[model samples]
Target: MPNVKPAMRVIYIPILLLFAAFLVIPLGILFIRSFETSEGFNFSNYIAVLSNQELLTSIGNSIKISSLTAVITTVLAFTLAYAVNCTKIYTPLKMAIKTGILLPMLLPTITYGFAIIYSFGNQGFITKLVGRNLVEIYGFNGLLIGYVIYTLPAAFLLINNSFKYIDKKFIIVSKLMGDGTLRSFKNTIVRPLVGTLGGAFVLSFIISFTDFGIPASVGGTYSVVATQLYQVMLGSIPNFNHGAAIAVVMLIPAVFGVLLLNYLEKRNFHYDKFGETELTPHRGRDVGFGIVSGVVLLAMLSVFAVMFVAPFVSSYPYDMTFTFKHLLDTFQSSDLTAVYKNSLFVALLTAVFGTCIAFSAAVLNVRTAVKGKSSLDTIAMMTNTVPGMVLGLSYLLFFNGSSLKGTFAIIVLYSIVHFFTTPYLMAKNALSKMNPTWETTGELLGDSWLKTVYRVLLPNSRSTVIEMFSYYFINAMVTISGIIFLVTAQTSLVSSKIKELQHFGKFNEIFMLSLLIFVTNLAVKLLCEAFQKKSNKQ
Candidate 1:
């Protein structure tokens, strides 16, 4: 027993420590810096952050916009997920609808901003569709619309899967026992998905809260914490202190959202393990409700269609010509190519290293009988609350004099740490699904723990590893806020370059670049799906 305890520490404690260093240590450093003063520790930074009228206004704006988005998106996603899952929609048609809902998520948020501008800007194609423009698609409107697109896939997927897990027999029994359609729906479907609904709302709120791209493009003088962080770092007068203070402020909402999600995940995640229940179709309500839901799904698809097709138009609404010149010029530019290469290299390295760290942490938490696994959990939970911009600032302070400052290595490292939790949770889910008895039997048969991991765990986890890779790659490609500080001119990422062109009002080039990113991410996602199927077959 003595040998076993120490051996578990030997295997698990290193992973726990690494997570703590990467995730927990940086936040502590941020707090320490926030309290630092010329004379001694003080709350001057916090005082300034809290006292500023502009800061107060920005926080208010963020809350108002995020609240609007949460309600609209949740209602829409719930409608779509319910209509398709509960009704007799054709399977292929259902899959296509699901794909369309997810298409926006695969693209970068910057792309959504550009797409919205071209579709609704002053000289936009659809702007003229009305005799005169009734409302402007800037500020709150643009932010809310972009958020719905940005978060649709996740919210839809979450609720859609939740709907699938509910037993349709419950609904059928209710109807046969004289419950009305609306009455039965409320009692059976909505009640069961309440926790998931809350989970989706909080998740959407957090994504919108931390996003830096959409507001930058179409916000049009709209002030929020994300854009405020950008303004602080602008024009060669880097305000690291102010930025860190704002970053710490942003951490409050993100932390609360994460805590809420953790609570809901624990309460509502059981249906998934209980397995999918069979459906009993309703005739009258299914037809009418399904048609209404289909219209909403079509509207969701129309947004993606506009985003994909707008780049091919030669000039805005004026020329209305068609050409591939925009595409040719975007990839043909040597500057853009360098940025693309930098982004690709960093994404590849992040996938490798992020996967390594997440896999290790998951194994340590699940397999090893170590005392400090709670430490790893704490790191992940705290990191999930840390916004990307704050993370960037933290790296600037922590690694400025170390061996990591101002290099491509640091950017890659930042990506790995910035995106650690998603993959960690994903891999943990995959690990938990497998029977722990597999490991026990292997140990009883005299196999070493290491051999059992290689021979048992890795093979069973091939799908998860691929999913982890896609998550890392897509996030790294679209990430703007964290790597923005780390990317030198020599090592510019595509995300930063897109922001550059947008600032210069090169809207055409911006849309083309966004299209390219969407295509590249789509290709990567497809590749991951293929690999998942191959692994399943094996």
Candidate 2:
């Protein structure tokens, strides 16, 4: 324990209210609805839902596809992380690989499904390039391809961060003790990364399992739990009981995934002294891993190449003429323009409010000895355990008919909660590294706690605050799940608008909007990085 200002505990009230109203109450309402029936409340709804063959098949399909995607994505993410960390590759090529791997995340997930269809579909750009039809972009193959791209960025971040704590000298010691190549590799690299590797797989699996954007665009005849839940709740005929039952069912795996991730994360290895150690040169290792990384990045990013061309062509694969009608037509519509502005409005507010709340929570958790600090930390990260669809459905249920329903405020709040854990963790980690005696020092100098924080802590935390803002802005701009059910006609976002367009076979508008979103998100990331570097220099 350390010296802490008692007045600082006042920060807990707003944070608690935020979670209680948005996270707890909504989930409780969902639980109640799951048991609701025509004859009062009972377990009949769950019975009926579990008994349905199609729903069961969707569950099985989610597991199978999510599992396979986790494996392939983990392998790709690990190889990329390895090449960046362990191998001595050319500087710019490695930088390109790092930047390219995260490009998929810069756009809405729905775009990925569309990209897959246009890239590997009948008249896909890749298809034309290869002069042949590619894999079926309808069922399992389509979902598998989209999911791998969707989850790779996050999985890579987790594994790559884990690499920093590992000391490579252990491999040298093992080699001196007569360890062979295979044995040395396992003992040094694989052993230290077991936890993060497992974490990557689990995170990838949950993300794929709960995603609705991809399945909505490319599901065709194959359905997953998210799509089924969407149909039941907002389809031609709404069934609240069945929808609630399915929502509850979706939480089962998320809960288990959270538990397993916690277990894996506990196996952390620490290094007392980290050195600027250079790896021994092996041209074979460098060339092999570098080529593999480059090839995989190319394959994943090649899916989106059509976005830049498909929207600018005259009926792709039929007419070889360049045109700007797609751009002109999309912008001419007031609705499309308003939707894009709405996305920017929501994203900006989410970043501002989200950064404040997350930073406050982190300041309390790391800088204060407040009672229940541990619980606050847990609550801050709890969003990771709930899937976006479930949270969206819960918000829709809890806030129905209230003033908050169909308002921009609700969307911003939900986005904050949905993407809160990562930013909060980022804040906590950055704050924990600062001087722990700032409060005491300020108090002795006759300064209030808030003043000290504003003058000292906030300035030191500028880079992290910028990062949290960027993360919130980018995610809020592209997210389609947690706020899908909450958006109404007046408060529509670009992502949901793209989904609406898909129903009418508007591929031109879809790719155009996707490009817009990707450019916006990429700009935010680049600006954040540059801002951080400039601040560090100052």
Q: What is the C-alpha RMSD of each candidate to the true structure, in Å?
A: 2.7, 1.4
lDDT of 2 by residue, 404-499 (tens): 999999999999998999999999999989988887788789889888889989999999999999999999999998788999999999999999
Worst 10 residues of 2 by lDDT: 1-10
Residue 182, model 1: Cα distance from true site in angstroms: 3.0
Report how far residue 480 has shifted in candidate 1, in Å.
1.4
Residue-level lDDT tens digits of model 1 in 173-283: 798899987899987788889889998899788888888888987787788878887777664687667667778888889878877887876666334334444566657
Q: Alpha-carbon error at 342 in model 2, in Å? A: 0.5
Q: lDDT for every model?
A: 0.78, 0.90
Q: Candidate 1: deviation at residue 225, Å?
A: 1.3
